[model samples]
Target chain A: MSQKSFVWFCLLPLAVVTTAFFLLPMARLVVAGAEGPHGLAGYLAILTEARYRATLINTVLLAAATTVVTLIVATIAGMFLQRHRFPGRAVLIAMLTFPLAFPGVVVGFMIILLAGRQGLIGDLSNRIFGEKFVFAYSIYGLFLGYLYFSIPRVILTIMAAVQKLDVGLEEAARSLGASPWAVQRDVVLPALAPAFVASGAIAFATAMGAFGTAFTLATNIDVLPMLIYTEFTLAANFATSAALSVGLGLITWLILALARSFSGSAVAAAG
Target chain B: MSTAGHGAAVRIEACGKTFADGTRALDPATLDIARGETLVLLGPSGCGKTTMLRIIAGLELPDVGGKVLFDGKDMTSVPIERRNVGMVFQSYALFPNMTVADNIAYGLKIRGVARGERAARVAELVALTNITGLENRRIDQLSGGQRQRVALARAVAIRPGILLLDEPLTALDAALRDRLRSELNRLLRALGITTIYVTHDQAEAMELGDRIVVMRKGAIAQIGTPREVYFAPKDRFVAEFIGAANIVEAPVENGVLILPGGRLPIECGATTANATVMIRPETIRVTEAGEGILSGIVDSVSFIGDRQRLVVSDASSKPLNVDAPNTIQARIGDRIGLSIAPDAVRLLPSEPRD
Candidate 1:
């Protein structure tokens, strides 16, 4: 065989696997989404139905909040961790990133151990205020769990970007009569913009589709993932569930694509 | 455009920088720079030249009891931002996010200058630095030389009292470095600002500095004009650092230095039985074999365009380097005589060899 034919033959396994496991399933899911009693309107029902619409809005808002909060917390912590050297710093970083090894279910369990009924916070509140305070089963608990896992991913990216920062830029800014805040605003943040866009997109996508944590928490949660889970298992509404699944994936993918395009244009204009 | 020279006389007293890890970057040294004078800290790498410049620029705080004064005002505790000093780094740290005009005008914007005034200042600096058409270009779009001009323009746009540059030309290629060195020298002279430049290149120190501070191993070895440092070096280190010098250690009897090749008269003050002396390569003239004050066989000859450098052995304990006129013809292993003026031989105090 010729060189190009040999290369194509080498890619035969990957092509077969992708078509069998990926394209076929995606095509089936799309067709199944339209095979229900509502037919083609099922996709529109995701936006027109009040219950589905509310759940979609809730998931988007949660993902956005997670991304914003993760970025802010990770940036500060990452800058400090990357810049300063002290005893136990390596250990601290190891502990912070230890969450990367955990699945979302484990993160949810840890949040429950901290804030669930009969958990640490509940026990302490019961002893101090004669009333138990618990929030582990609520959206607040899910938000906290998402933040727990999102922080490690975002912080690692931010720290890497921070390490590559040129100290001369900061010194130049200060020499140009910029205050500390102004230096960060003008130089450091702009330099780290690509990192933010990359890591924030990951954080947003992860929060948007995080199912294991919501599963281990409450079943009544109004997130799209939980909603789809209920519609698929409890209601056995395959068409609506598949449609909602497509909607969730498309929405998350659309937001990420938007972010990438915006950041891409920004980088081009910066140059 | 405003061209009112706002140079400030800077004085650093007893400034020493001992890093957190107990490494002494700079020894306690005191020096003063006159208004509108360009003082260069010249030394090898890790010789505390950059540390000294940082102390003066307020980027690094000196150890206790050290003070930096501007026009006799104590500025020891002042930070770099409040010190009103402009700094150009070796990396030419122009903000990559800002256009050239925006980078030049950033300082004015920080100072809350009016938009119209900031534009005028940016225009003046762009013209001054000869980067007028690059105003809208981002830093990454510019070449190394253009980035350097943008960095200088950004630093000077604020009308700072003192300019501190740290090896600004070391990042460029050789040809560009030489060209920019002369251009930068002219620019510094035109600005007439009290500037402190740091570089390991002796040629740069000679070309740009009015007074060069030769440093070594965290200490100031000598401080003088380029000519003074080159011709009348205070010690063997400065003599070897500023230019090529042949150090000959020999016994001095009466007024003549006893060498293996021949005895040469010394005009320097009374010397010990064993004396150390410095002879510049250019000072030793090549003549007929055995005709001048010293005679030896040529070991090697290198033709260096303007001058031919000859290494003559058997003339001293170590081989002597002689820079002869290019017109003079010499071959290896040929006997050659070298002429040296007594005044050109400088006696250096014997520093115990480590």
Candidate 2:
């Protein structure tokens, strides 16, 4: 056999395994949900019900907030690490990316230990303000938990982009009478726009689909994933749970599509 | 149009640059660039020419002791934004996010120029660079030559006091490089801007420089007009670098240098008993044995379009190259007489050969 054919033969099994384990299941779920009794109406329930609607809106809002906060923190950290050679820079970089390895539930538990009522920061705030301060189950608390995972992802993505950027552009801008801020705004930021959009999309998608952290911290909130879990376990309604799952999938697809459209243009502009 | 004669507008006094990692990229170097004149910094790779240009643009700071003066003002501490200088990079570095017009107007906008003024200036520069209809096109939409023109327009749009170009045409193809080199010279002359151009290409330096500064590893080798640097090189390195030269060892006796295979009369006042002889290929002429001072046999002959390159071997088998017009017919095995004009041969300082 030819070398090219031999290489294709070697890759065939892995491709089949991926298709069987991942793509087939996703296709089955999509097809089953579309052919269900209520058809597309079951997916529309997420947009029609006030509780589900608010939860969907809140999920999008929280994802956007997480993306924005993550982008700011990550961009600053990435630029600093790229341009400076401070002491312990490697240690700081490694520490920043450490959260990416931690499971979502572990991050949620750690946040609870630090910021929950009667926890470390909670006790300190209680002593300082003379009142019990609670953030463990709050929406803001969920945001903090989401950020623990999102920030590191954003940082790693942006750091790669920043490191690969040609520094001559900044020099050219500065020599053309651009201040440092103007250089960052007009040259650096525009060059980093693709990374910003890509990391923001990934962070938002991760936050939206987050299950373990949201379940551990904000159990009271009815995000689509949590509502589906509740429908299947608490209410023992398999069809409704499947329908809610379908709705969540559709929302994720729409979000991804929107992100793709926006980021594609941003990438084109940057290139 | 302003008719002021071109003269020195920027002076670099003992400028030096050492990076944080202790790499002395630029040693103490001083230069004066004339107003409305093009000064080309010619050097090999890592010769600190780009660093000097960067120092002039205020993109890099000179370490320890150095002063950059523009228009007789000590601008050592002035920020790049307030320095009012423009730069073109080797990679062009056009703003990919903006259209051609926006890239040209970026400096004007940063200086808070009015909308009407910025638009007018962008239009004027676009027209000047011959990219009039491409103002609304994005950077990626333009070809390589178009992008280079846009970069030039962007740098000159604000009428900066000093324009610095760092190997601007090095990224272009050969044919395009030649075209853009002449176009750039025309544009800079029309603008009458004080420009410092840096390139490692000797041909580019010779064609574009009003005065050329030849630099070697972190130091200035020689600074002079193109004719001075090329014809009268100060050292062996400068002589061999600017163009092809035949370097021969010779002994200076009775005002006539005795080469290994031939004797050439030279007039350089050399106190040393021995000196090196430098002769360009074009300076040597080939004729019959009785008509020329030295005789040799033609070892190789090759046609190079408009000229025929002849390599002649003397009694010692030392090969000397002579370039003649294409019409001169000399076969490889033919006997030839080579003679160099006494005035053409230069006696260089006897030093350890590089």
Candidate 3:
């Protein structure tokens, strides 16, 4: 075959898959909403209702909190893993990234086992407070579950970035009369900014779109993903559920775009 | 600035280091660098020259053998940051995240110099390195030569007691290397800073150093001025490493050394009956009369820039190199008489260590 035909042949399957899975569904969603009784009313419903508004707020807050917490814990852990030659460093890294391979539902279950009424920390809290502490039944529980998954993702990404950083920069800083802490603060931390931003954004997006963990840990907490599931299953509101999905996707896209822009500036400044 | 008559003297006595992988990186090295003198540690790779520099800079601690002294004060236990020694790395190691001004001001800032003082110091260093206009440029924007100069300026900005340079010119091209080498020597001399430069380039050592310490296998092979080390090498390795030499097997009898094709008289202060006679390539000349030690045929001739090199072969085809000025008209396959001055021929001891 000619080169043009061969190139077209190579892209045909990807085009067909993208159309069938992504483009067609998105087109149908847009058209279906337009065809609804109040045309565009369903999309407005997501922003108008107090419950939906609360869900959106909770989604954003939880994602932001998880991102911050994950970034702090993961960056510290990754730096420690990078700079120190401590025993069990390899094992620690493997264990930290092990959660990335786990299913979200499984991670939620593990969190429940550890922070539920009868679990290890749950038992200690119960004994201390003289009551069963239900960490699996609140917004706090969703955060715990999200953090369980987000921490590993952040750690792996930031660790790869840290490992790739030129070590001579730190040595130079130290030789230039910078103390160890100053070297880390002035040289190492600034160099890791882009990676930190990218990883934090990824963790935030993952936490926002997470459904299985939120569903498994939901009690009275109404996050966006759980609310959409409730709209689809109990309220029989597929149109509104699709609208919420679209909203979450757009929010995630906006955040990821902002992160990309920030990281691009960071890389340019570093270069 | 003090404009003191003497700089700080560094003394490293019997320092040794062994890595965790069982490789002895440095083994019981002892050196004393005089005030305001530039010392070049010359060696091939894995010779511990860089390691010694790192040890002096307090980046690496020697394994409990001796102490490092600066100006007669012991600083063996001091940390790198508190040691107040400047270092220029082979990679330049310019901070990519900072501008050139910020990089030069980094040490001053860490030392808690006030803002005005730090700025003044940075400005002074930029001017000293002739990069005053490039201060605001990021390190990535600067050329290799600019970056190296910035590194040198940054190193000297803190007014370090001693400066350590680890093959700083090896990364540059040949032309840049030569230019920077001369510039570096001039700067160091003008600053009058006690400096330790580590390099494998003998020409750089010869040109830039007040004293050259040739190292081999983590030990000092010889330490002397360039002229002392070059013309009066203490061992065969030093003689061969410093320049190209013609080493021939010779037996000493009655204070005369016998070669394969002829006999030559030499002195080595030893009574060994067997030795190797070493003569510099430029020392051997072609004479018109056959009154010299060896008569040979010119096997090959090649022209260097200002000189011509000829390889002379005897009956047994043992080759000896002869360097002559380009003014001489010599040809291949010409029968020639090779003359060696008695003072130019030195006897290498027979029982030489590898």
**Best-fitting candidate, scored by DockQ:** 2
Better of 2 and 3 by lDDT: 3
Which prediction has the highest TM-score against the true structure? 1
The TM-score that candidate 3 achieves is 0.95
Model 3 — interface RMS deviation?
Answer: 1.2
lDDT of 3 by residue, A39-65 (tens): 787787767889888888888989999
Among the numbered candidates, top lDDT falls to 1
Tell me the deviation in Å of residue B352 in model 1. Answer: 2.2
Model 2 ranges off by over 4 Å: A1-40, B1-8, B269-272, B315-317
Please give the interface root mean square deviation for model 2, in Å: 1.2
Q: Tell me the deviation in Å of residue A160 in model 3.
A: 2.4
> Pairing residues by index, what is the TM-score of model 2?
0.94
Show where candidate 3 strays beyond 4 Å.
A33-38, A41-48, A84-87, B1-7, B268-272, B289-291, B315-318, B352-354
Compute the DockQ of candidate 2: 0.74
Worst 10 residues of 2 chain A by lDDT: A28-37
Using Cα atoms, each model's DockQ against the true complex is 0.71, 0.74, 0.71
Count of clashing residue pairs in every prediction: 0, 3, 0
Ranking by lDDT: 1, 3, 2
In model 1, which runs have C-alpha deviations exceeding 4 angstroms? Answer: A1-13, A127-130, A268-271, B1-4, B269-271
Give the per-residue Cα lDDT of candidate 1 at A214: 89
Question: Residue B36 error for model 3, in Å?
Answer: 1.3
